[model samples]
Target: MQLFNSRLLRERMQRFSFPAGGEFKKKINVIAKWQKSLRDSDLSKTKEISIQGLFLSKFFGEVLGYTTQADGKKEWNLTQHPGNDIDARIPDGSLGFYSSDKSATKAVIELKDAMTSLDRRQSARRENFTPIEQSYLYATKYDGCNWIIVSNIREIRLYNKSKTQSYYESFNVLQLEEDEQFKRFYFLMSKDNLLGDGALSPLDELLQTSEAQEKSISGDFYSAYRELRLKLFKHLRENNVGYDSSILLEKAQKLLDRVVFILFCEDKGLLPREILKRAFERGVSSFLDSDQRVWLEMKGLFKAIDRGNDKVSPPINGYDGGLFAYDGLLDSLRIGDAIWKEIVELAGYDFESDLNVNILGHIFEQSISDLEQLRSEFDGLELHTSRANRKKQGIFYTPENITHYIVENTLGRYLEEHPDRLPVIRILDPACGSGAFLNQAHTYLQKAWKSAYEQGEIKSKDARYGTLFDYNPAENDRTILLNNLYGVDLNEESVEITKLSLWLKTARSDEPLENLDRNVRCGDSLVQSREIAGEKAFEYRKEFGKVFEEGGFDIVIGNPPYVRQELLSPELKEYCSLNFETYSGVADLYVYFIEKGLALLREGGYLSFIVSNKFLRANYGKKLTGYIQKNYTLVELMDFGDLQVFEDATTYPCIITIKKTIPEGPMTFKYLRLETLEVADLRAELEEKGYEVTITPDSGGWS
Candidate 1:
């Protein structure tokens, strides 16, 4: 099982043995000391800076020098007072430094050792700060200096203050180390990685220590606490559990009753700790808040503590033995069976052990002969689910038809001929919403695994391919699924749902199982950094590894998000320009994600995306088309022309597929021309079961 490190907040609470007030005080002190050091520093001179300049420096790091201007050249204007007399002034050593020649204040420099949290926020939230709002105030208050540069004691940023338009354009010089005999103040800002190691702060170390302790709470204790709390709350609402401290007595009575019943039936004893951990891991406490935790603890105390002796029972559950043993025992009981059934039904899976067949959606309907109870269970879910948006439906599945066609036309042909070679395929969906594309690809590979297992090419199925029934896939085949399917998305909720979707779909046709942190994960595909945990949490993956040198994904497929040009956040637009080499038409965020996805794949990785048709017909889309024409080989264009691909979605969407490395010739592209939203015949379909059909245009065409 994969263990996630405890977060900073939890760690602090654990170590402090209370709350965050004291720790926050310490953080404030540290900030003060850092600020004082900058004020006292002898290396540079300071001047009164505009609030906007201070905020900008705090955010983007202090500017050392301009690329175009000479040292100590103040070319820009930060003066709020229009006719203020500008002249030489002494540096105050807080906001930034003035030039030595002092002709025009070209740069602002603020010193620092480590970056503060507020430093980065300054770059983006320009309109929110108080000081920056009064750039004119700074100009009238002090003479000279148009810019401000603040450093995290390492990295420096240069901001050109443009208060008239209300923003600052800034750049980072990365890491700037302390030096002597510098040619000019600006030269010091030229280097990157100012300090070695970039070690974590003392506070960070303390936080990590606290996190280690929180996860150590035993399962039995947790479970007992939870049950008592839930019962107490239910009682409080219904007036049953009682109003006094005897709520504990009530919970104890309930547990004792269960114990009596169980003891009567069998010789086994119950451990509460093991039960609680299992519940947490299965997302049982997902909605529980701090109040609920306190209630549970209080209720557990009243029920479990021996009143006269004033002592709680010794916890019987151990992490591996007692905890897991309890889980195994529970799994055999009616309660466990019911819970597992619910999870299975929610994921929309169906598999037949006798026929060795697996179906994608609506599992219980075909598997179980009795449907009355299950139908009622589904009805309850509808009421619960009505509040959620489409992203929650688990219905935004990648149409399998598109997958089969893309894989066959690109990777399949090669795999079919080779036969013996394991397809060293690496597929990525930059905006892999709910792992739809990966799920489809994973299913295809599972079929391949079953085929290999049947052929007796391998032995011993991995836990991933294990089932409750007789069906199993070869170990090698399971590895194929594990290795080939990887996706990244920014939505935390979507990432969890997507992981569950992939896990449910990929499980052996007849099984109940679990996996800890596989290929699916939460992340911004564009802003991935090496600092982030998780294998798929790639920071700039397009720039490194086999994918960069050899090319990226073998099959890329998904419905990338369509963010409007007017709606693009300034930070997002700027981010795209800084990272992506080629982009089109303030082209949608989806377009940028697709371009990044394509570039990350191997030479011939096929990309199929359900994109907005605006790129096909809109004026901005023209530039996007021109870009695709120049870079990619348009292999298949399934244009869902005039289709309401999205009912609730505002954008008129289309599906297009292209290969990264297409051979020279008139490429054969398929066009799916839709006439209406309801017409099944109008939808295109590939030759695969459960794959939907839509209206399609001719297959062979020139770009």
Candidate 2:
């Protein structure tokens, strides 16, 4: 625990030796044979059990020098639960040491075949790339264990338990082919190192070094994003002049979204790395000399991205989701060369890693200095102030924990019940502000579809895109984004961000982005009739006739926006009164969203929304409560009473999940009230609480 250097630890590990070097040498030759066989055979035919025997057991037993027995008694637990008081659930295998003449588990070992990837970004990873988020869960759950060793046969990685995810070390199998790589791998991971010559193991020394480095580093993606945003805002405000406030704001927002996405593409390898950075540097000189536009470098790339392979200097594939579409006003606008220098400098930092899309779409934080200053500078325009715009429009940020909960219970339940429906299932987020719900849903289905593909449950013909023989789960991630995920936002910019977020989430290099404008639309989701809202009217049967004809969506779920009754226009109130019998008078804006969302649900379909808890007790909610009582089957409900779920606002909220089927018996549903605002295994917590509610016509006050 005292001051330790990774260099000194490595030198010590090099001196430590195993007595069974002959066995290790024989295992190395066997590994080469297995590697050749893997290359020769179809990876699809490779069995995980075979991999466990062929690669995993030998490598761990020989190279890493972990023993299976102690005192002639077996000391390794295999193919069963850890058998601990905490987290008794079974994992693939466990690495252990001898203690009390029995195997004492050290780390949960998960072995994967060639099928799944160790890549963190790919959907093919199925969100199982460990030591990131899942490791934290394992750290606490795996009894007193603090480590997990995971491998996909091709590579092996080691992660230590932490309250938060810390970076880990990965030793690829290819490392065994080279002396230096093998030495490094053996030094850190060998059983001799774990049982060090000194008081602490080398891995323990490395952990201390990493933890210190982690503590020294600070600041998050939002801060970095805000800094970059400030620079852009200042440049836009000072330099641009030919347009009105709205146009100017639109140009600024669009340019920022596109640039961030392009930067993301560069990091993802979807576009050539440094395509923008190099071009920006090259264009600085060309800008003052050229007779064409001022920022010609980006314009050319934008055009090439829009037109597919038609134009290619920096070599970009088409990404036409309205993000790269010709924005004449935005493209033509020129900024001082100095701004581009700052942009090129900041572009070196990875935005995709830093800027998460969950809170990225529109600037929602009212406390941000840039937004507060922009509000003052814009005077009364309300251009850059998205919080005001969002409040007025009745949209808010939905947390991923919330989204994951709702999506799992709703879409997750549906998928579990009908696994065959993966190819044809439909999900929608009517008020998908920045595509949080849609993104969650996309990820959920991506994992399901990928698992099904790996298990041979999904046939070649079931592929969403490409030929039968060429069915790829990676490409299907895009097809699923295009086909399965659907959303509607009143804000045009929000709709664009939704599309951009989805594109960024699943975009493949040089692959055409399926135009998603038709899928995720921009309109007032509550307004249906033309006479009521005219151009903004989003009639379900008319605008989404295909969805209607297909018996509406299979699941409709999201965090419907929070807007008070007073914000409703008289016309909107009247329209609501005439159209919906759910909530009488000018109810909270979320009430109308509920009625519309449930109405759009296919029979036996599910609809869930986390909205104001006031509807359960307030006099205004009588109509809605009665309507749902008589018309739908309540599945589950959670009163997040007094528990502050949203960071931006203090509101009493409840999550309600409904099945679009009229009740056949007394109103009974699983329900609970959270005492604390912590994100954990919600389903397990609900079951552990063991609470339910029943209501009848003669029911009295329950609280």
Candidate 3:
């Protein structure tokens, strides 16, 4: 079980480099000139300003070829310390950049020092898309190229308005005299070519003697194999190396062969022919010759065959078409249309919209009981705890009432309008702990589809069952899951829980559950900031092929994570800054998801989500609002009104629904201002008001 040691591998990678000598100095001079202009102006360093003038000057200089004037002085004049004691001032010497070209200037950049790293700046950078946002203003006022660069000395990155691309370009300086190790880091930062070609890379570092690799491989073969696979994938990605599909498949075959050869040789002593024949009956026959078979069989003579019916064998059964071999594999794979159908059914919203209030409302109440039991079960589990208190410390389930409201209010109107059509929806819950949203969504679709099927308005089909639950048992099931939903999160455990919830919702109670690996995946959605790479969640988009070749989703919906500013990882934050091109500042991970959801949708598609009420009025939310106002028709907005939707929530929550393409507005959506909601009335209330609702917080006004 060989695995690449990332720390050591990174050290190895840093040994290679290409220098940036005089070219680096010229860039620095441009920074100096910009800095001079800022120093000559009225703006000075305060603990209160939110803009970093000197860094902005330098960044703008580089982005626009040293062309921006210090016209931002007036905007910079008003300065007050953040009352919350958060770092509010646009500090002196902060680095920033902007593009003025219409296509490129649509993007924005902000730099920060101290509390502001490339990561922190990115949050603010990802959400702001205003015509005169600090980043946009800088770009517009500076009037230059269509990209912006913002950085502190340790890291530098860019924002491209033209392509809506943002990403960190360099981790460290690219000086000629920098240490060799540092140069390797520079190479990684400066050139995407330093990484591999294509997207897939194979694992081959299994023989490394390093401690990390050894630590990862010291477990059982299966455990070691899994770890090694992850390492292999990570190594290729970190180095930016890519390989072809044929290469990846070939590598997989070779690795499996090596495993079989080693296991057989050790088990049979000398690889005896008779033993090989038995093993071959299970599929090993396809890979070995007579000599290898004989060798493998000979080893079996010395091997201990300790027997219990439950003791797993290398190949549990011979290839019998009547039994659990191929069928099991197919079942596990859940390949193609079979899998797709399941997902679409699970994600069905059309029925939910058409259902009368009494029936759907009753179903939601029953779900709440199930959720409470789930919460109790998880609360008893032993796991790492991040926050204090017992109830809030474990896997959080969305209150059933809230889930019902989210589904109906956010999606009901659109679904009602197109009852004849199954709206192809794409939704993601960035921190989908226990998969409350996906589960609720699955139920929403299932109930709707079932009703239609019962009424004979739609014909539904049954799924085929397989005898064996083997390697590909989930293959067909996977396809079913893919059709309905897609999600990404950094929490592996949460992903697992999400899959289980989705499976439970889709499976028939009387039949043995289909052994399906779900469409839900584990990843940092913001990490891919620029390119999605080989992650399965992203793969779904490519696998479908239609969206990439034709267009994107018809609808995007979900509840994104609510990670506080201080809790985020630096790498994740940096990646967000470099990749997410919309707004920046206390970015709220949910904000990026909204931006991504919007991007993944087709022009006329709808976008919906429930987020912090703060964003509705926060300065950070302004650019996002502006972008939505300019590009989308605000179909509806619902303020749940000071309701503690989360058991642990300290802030008010708001739900917003909009369509991607707005046709010449002065559009007035329905508006609802409610004091509080009973768990039972959520669906009815939202439905009665219809799609044209505007709900405003007590403190903020809405037009």
Overall local distance difference test of candidate 3: 0.41
- TM-score winner, 2 or 3: 2
Cα error, candidate 3, residue 91 (Å): 62
Indicate the residue-level lDDT of 607 in model 2: 94
Error of 1 at 323 (Å): 15
Give the poorly placed runs of model 3, Cα more than 4 Å off: 1-386, 389-396, 419-430, 459-482, 509-518, 529-540, 543-550, 569-574, 687-703
Compute the lDDT of residue 152 as modeled in candidate 2: 74
Top candidate on lDDT is 2
RMSD of each: 27.2, 7.0, 25.8
lDDT of 3 at 527: 50
- Local accuracy of candidate 1 as per-residue lDDT tens digits, 411-527: 443344333433356666666664556655665565454444433554543354353222356443455545566666665435544554454443332222233244555666765
Candidate of highest TM-score: 2
Comparing 1 with 3 on lDDT, the higher-scoring candidate is: 3
Candidate 2 lDDT tens digits, 160-279: 653112135667675575666666677666776554444456666666764464333213444555566666766776677655655565666677677778787887678878777877
Relative to the true structure, how large is the alpha-carbon lDDT of every model? 0.39, 0.65, 0.41
Q: Which residue runs of candidate 1 sit more than 4 Å off their true CA positions?
A: 1-414, 417-423, 451-477, 506-518, 528-551, 581-585, 662-668, 676-703
Query: What is the RMSD, in Å, between candidate 2 and the native fold over all Cα?
Result: 7.0
Per-model TM-score, in order, reads 0.41, 0.75, 0.41
